[model samples]
Target: MIYNFEDLKEIVKSKVSIKRFNHIMAVVDMSIKLAKIYNADIEKCKIAALLHDICKEMNKEEMKKICKNNFSEDLTDEDLENDEILHPFVGAYWVEKNLKIEDIEILNAIKNHTLGNKNMTLVEKIVYIADAVEITRNYPGVEEIRNLVFKDLNEGILFEAGKKEKYLESIGKKSHKNSYAMQKSIREEIKKKN
Candidate 1:
């Protein structure tokens, strides 16, 4: 039950691997910056970023128990089968149940950070994009996406989604349905702009 900022850091440090901790720190820094740029609630953004991957390293059996205990429409049985893709949902529920956080926006940001949603809020977008473009992330085109985010958030979102889809397809893996839905929504929004 990490209630405060310090407690959050301490818990994350103790639980996650060193590499994951560094990535979490990077997300915290980047989420704060993006929160300011996008006029989001910085507190919520920080909370979301800090706990976004709370279950990332958990074994599938452990994560499955958490989901079964707290499962809802937001986290269905089907979602539990794919812990790799549905970790965000577990993280979100864990935050709410364990940390006693009742902020829907923060919970939603955590829940949808990985796959995204149809109409994402600024905070949600910030968390999702921050997790990808944080300084520690060094995949190809990350710098380009980082720069794009500062200039045009929606374009950055589209680029990230497109990149993710392409990578998944290249590996013969189908992206979560939510990702495809969000991509469609982003494309539609981009179409409206052009």
Candidate 2:
């Protein structure tokens, strides 16, 4: 079904975990603004924002278990490693199998919100950008990127990913070796007009 505000609210009520729901709401608000500005699919943006982290609390082991049972075999090893990166793919599966959502756009947005795919659609970019810049977020330089999101999406995307990479380095986390997909995505987006 096409999701509007009330429908989103209902879905949130039914599907959201208590601790994460507030974050979801924050993303939803930001996503709506982005959808308006970017002329994206509003319902898909809302649904994707609402469901982006549906499996976030799952640990790597749990994620693996779920993926083993539910995931298609076409996923590569990098995709498996990145399973712990974000839960949007698992979330999409849950949202479909449990929540009865069947829209391909919504599923794609949820699937791609993290470590975004190359040549992302408007809906995918809307959710990814919105999730990064939501008000509940307090990462360094978020306000700068938040401002840039309205003015120059590609710049904001590059800046945010760069910021995240730096933050990971600072926290002594291993930075992901630049995946070929990310390189391709960066190159594709670099060519786009704001």
Candidate 3:
């Protein structure tokens, strides 16, 4: 089940909507650029970006089913109910089980793209930031964050994580444990650099 890049693209395209597919392509483009800048594995970034949202279009029931089946111990009832938060876990599992992509970096990148984790590899950071700052993404402070990412990945991630936490609070949603751990890890990294 090893797919060439084009095969992967086609599979992703068929699985997601046109808008979702466009976002995925933008993420792929941004990922490659960040990978080149950060000296990460470009192919892994490409693969991770392509499959990051592969299960985004799935119905909530199906996503919940997948999460329950594969990540039952790792995810909570709230996590499984939140499609926005649930897709990454399902995406990673789907990519591994269906697409036969066994690369741990790629799978973790896909899994961590949504909420992020305590210790993200270079490839994971590339995919995570690229998904946020891709050219098509237009948010209030996205331009500033995008600029910050190219200059310093850790700072950019820290900023984005803070924003995500605030946004979730604004919407009356609790930030996931992984996001908090990631922010803590990135903050420590920034502290070391300073």
Candidate 4:
């Protein structure tokens, strides 16, 4: 079944809490802004941003069940155990299986939004950074990271990845392998630019 943007918005609203819905909206707005600036596909950004966290509110068992049922081969043991990282995988599957979204870019953006991979497309990067630095995110240094994203997308990603790594380490959580890969890839991209 084909779904329009508004259809997607309403569906997401009903699935997640009001607070999560608001965050999704903020990410959508931020994604559009970044997409315009970066020459990425705006529609893809909006769709990806809206669906990135679709499974975030789901219980761990539900998310794990989806993961086990659909793409168990693709997930690591660590991913199954980590709720923060697991939702993206389940979300990607949910959108593909339930919503009939065939676009690999959108699926990948949703899958990678939580722990970005080694090679992120423009839409992927835009959605990832937008989710992190959206308007409602009021963590320390967020404004600076937001500004840096507008200045240089790769730099913004690098900084955000660093901050995420540090935070994960502080909490005694091991950073996902994809996160490390993303940082390495972004650093190389930045080097190529300079």
Per-residue CA lDDT of model 1 for 169-190, tens digit only, reads: 9998777778877778877888
Best by TM-score: 3
Question: How far does residue 3 in candidate 1 sit from its true spot (Å)?
Answer: 5.4
Q: Clashing pairs in model 1?
A: none
Model 2 is weakest, by summed lDDT over 10 consecutive residues, at 174-183
**lDDT by residue for model 3 over 16-124, one digit each (tens)?**
9999999999999999999999999989999999999999999999999988988886689978778998999999999989988999999999999988998899999
Model 2 steric clash total:
0
- Residue-by-residue lDDT tens digits, candidate 4, 119-185: 8999999999999999999998899899999999999989988888888889998777888889998
lDDT of 2 by residue, 9-116 (tens): 676656557768888889989999989988887878887888888777767776766666766453545656766554776877777887788987788778767666
Off by over 4 Å in 2: 4-8, 58-61, 69-86, 172-180, 192-194
Q: What are the runs in model 1 whose C-alpha is more than 4 Å off?
A: 1-3, 68-81, 188-194
Order of quality (TM-score): 3, 4, 1, 2
Candidates 1 and 3 compared by lDDT, better number? 3
lDDT of each: 0.85, 0.75, 0.91, 0.90
Estimate candidate 4's RMSD in Å: 1.7
User: Each candidate's TM vs. the true structure?
Assistant: 0.89, 0.80, 0.95, 0.94
